[model samples]
Target: MIRDKIRELLKKNAEAETNFSLEKPERAEFGDYAANLALVLAKERKENPRKIAEDLIGKIKGNREADIFEKIEIAGPGFINFFLNKDAVLEEFKKLSKLKTLLKFKTPKSKIQIEFISVNPTGELHIGHGRGAFYGEALSQVLKLTDYKVEKEYFINDSKESSQIKELGKTVLDEGTSYLTENLKSQISKLKTKIKNLKLEKPKNLYGEAGYLIAEEIQKDNKKFIEKELGIKFNNWISEEKNLRQKNYFNKILEILKNKNLVYKKQGAFWLKTSQFGDDEDRVIVRTSGEPTYFLSDIAYHFQKIERGYKKIIEIWGADHQGHQKRLFAVKKALDWQVDMEILISQVVTIKKGEEIKKMSKRKGEVILLKDLLAEVGKDAARWFYLQKSLDTHMEFDIELAKKREEKNPVYYVQYGHARMASILRKAKSGKISPPATFTFAEDAEILLIKKILEVFDVLEDAIKDYQVHRILSYIYELVYVFSVFYRDIRVLDSKQERERLFLVKETKKILANLLRLIGVAAPERM
Candidate 1:
């Protein structure tokens, strides 16, 4: 809101239209906020940047906008730095009572559908899949809090694959016939654990029946683990096989492409003209064997999403699908769809022990499964570690660091800050002392802490726009770091201004709790 007010003031005085950047100055002497409007305007208008900054300052000073800033100065080449008035900062803090309402004004509400963790119902979800799961859920939470109508979806790929079917058949047969090799025993044990209702009797169509049963068991287990262990609940579970069975759905997609002149028969296969829309080569939608390819099914699935009338569709995918993004976008272009679509690719996650990096391969049966990771550290620690980094950056999960219970662990450090604040609030409640109307923060640490707290709404607003939920982690770490300093240097319960300090502590606790909830982590009241 403060940034908006400053932008409004700058826009009224500028000679030409330009996109300006307002950010916190890196140095304390620069000011609370800095704008690079003069630099931008200078490049466009061919004027001295410092002169442009001076002129902007003159116009702002002439208006006598005392409530916004106490001082405005030109710094560096063209940067305009503004020191916010202390009273204005205090007024912003007072609005914390209506914080939720304040956040709603930051973004336009829209109906959005986000699909993530749509792994095939063939095997257990490994730690790689956990990254997308954590990222998607956190993004969904932020969107919901920011007033978007969000539909969290998991697309189940239950269509039959011949190789997978045979594998399932062998496993089931091995278990049923009691030829229990170590690997077969392990597979049967895991299957039984995941699918409590599994009845592995020998059927006439061995592979077909076995595949169906395996997929059913996987879908059930995946849903339970996601909802109960990971604390994520999807609004919709869209089954690909079910959608494929819908009357003429696949046919409708082919017809749409044909009408657009985007399909062709080449080498005894039906190909989509993906190269015309920017793909490296044309892609086959239907193979020479007369069976539709996975690409065709994906196109139909997106068409179904479009028909559902969502304004935006977001897909969280793994890095392995990086090359598929262009083909998917080409399909959207071929269909001339109006809905906005975004594909976010989460990079690989490597788990590390003390000195050795653990390599994982589900096919090789040498992998850290999601359930195992959850069991090792916990849902809270796992989610926090996965969500703390950018989705596009490859991350290494340090098992040792995650297991630590002290300040060295970021999750523990943040939770400890909340627990400490909760303790302070509990003490204040027991004393039955109301916070003072007139407050004075004599300590510099208290002022810094308030500044950090006031910046959270802006940080969250940026996170929503950029879809970089990692920013929330950075903000929490900084907020808690400031709080740690304040807690160490300033006395709250036994201070001369106990009630006012307690008020600050209470506000900090609320923010910590809200942030933890956004990332799907628990903010424990006690360490």
Candidate 2:
């Protein structure tokens, strides 16, 4: 909102179209906000940048009468720096008492569907899947907090023809009917122990029977480990098997593709003209063996999503499926759907303990389970570590660091700041201290903490626009660090400034709690 107000003023004062950049100045002396509009307009209009900045400042001063800004200055060739009035800043701090009502952000009235961690129901969820689950859950919370109608979904890849499911069946049959490899032997032993009635004899349709058993086990594990342990609840659990069984669903999709001239039969196989829609090559929807490929089912699933009337659909996919993105987009183009669809690819998670990199392979039964990881650290630490990094980049999750109870751990540090603030408030309340009608911020640390506290709203807005949830981590970390400095340098209990300091501590705690909750991490009152 602050950035928007500044942009409006810049646009109104500019004579021509200009693309400018606005951001907080790195140094405190530079000002609270900085804009490069004069530099951009001067480059476009061939005018002196300093002169343009002066002219823009004049217009801003003439148009704005409110005491929102304390000072506006030009510096360093063309940049315009703005300082907010201290009264305005304090007013924002006061509003934090009713933050939810005061910061009622306006968002578009549209339904959005977010599908994430939709792994095939063939095995237990690994650490990589945990990353996706945490990221998706945190993103959903962020969107909801910003006033968006959000639907979180888990798309189960459990079709009968799935290659993974078929492999699982083969594994089960091999273990049941013959000697099992060391890799799969343990899993089959566990499965047999769990399902007492599981027959050791090979069935007539081993693939179907074994696949069903494994899929059922996977679903059960997902409910217990993923949903319950990790606290991620899905609004929809879409089953590919169910969708595939829907009468005429696949056939209807084929017909739609045929009507659009997007599919053709050749060499006893059906192909979609994906290359025409920016894909590298045409992709097969149906094989020569008379079985539909997984791609066809995926297209149908997306169609179902659109049919449900979502204005936007966001798919959080693993980086391994990056190549499939274009083909899916081609399917959307073939259907001529007007809805917005985005595929957010999450990179791999590399787990490490000290200097040793832990190898993870699900098929080999050599992977860190999500439940095990949650047990090792905690839900809050796991979620924080998983989400504190960018989704598009590889993350190295250090087990030892995550388990630490010191400042080296970011989650602990942030949560400690919150706990520390809560202690301060309790002390103030016990002492019957009340905030003064007016206050003065004399200490540099005090002013710095207030400035950092005021920045959460801007950070939240930027995260919503860019879908970069990691930025919130950076903001809260800095806020906590500043608060730590304030606590160490300034006294709070039994001082003349005790009440005023308590107010700042309370506001800081609110922001820290909000940010932690947004990331689905707990904000403990005591550590």
Cα lDDT of model 1 by residue, 368-396, tens digit: 78988889898888999999999999999
Candidate 2 achieves a global lDDT of: 0.81
**Model 2 — which ten-residue stretch has the worst lDDT?**
175-184
Q: How close is candidate 2 to the true structure, as a TM-score?
A: 0.92
Candidate 2 lDDT over 290-340, as tens digits, reads 777889888888888888899888889987899999999887876788898
Indicate which candidate wins on lDDT: 1
For each candidate, the alpha-carbon lDDT, in order, equals 0.81, 0.81
Q: Model 1 segments beyond 4 Å from truth? A: 64-66, 98-102, 161-209, 429-435
Give stretches of model 2 more than 4 Å off: 15-19, 100-102, 175-206, 359-366, 429-436
Clashes of 2: 0
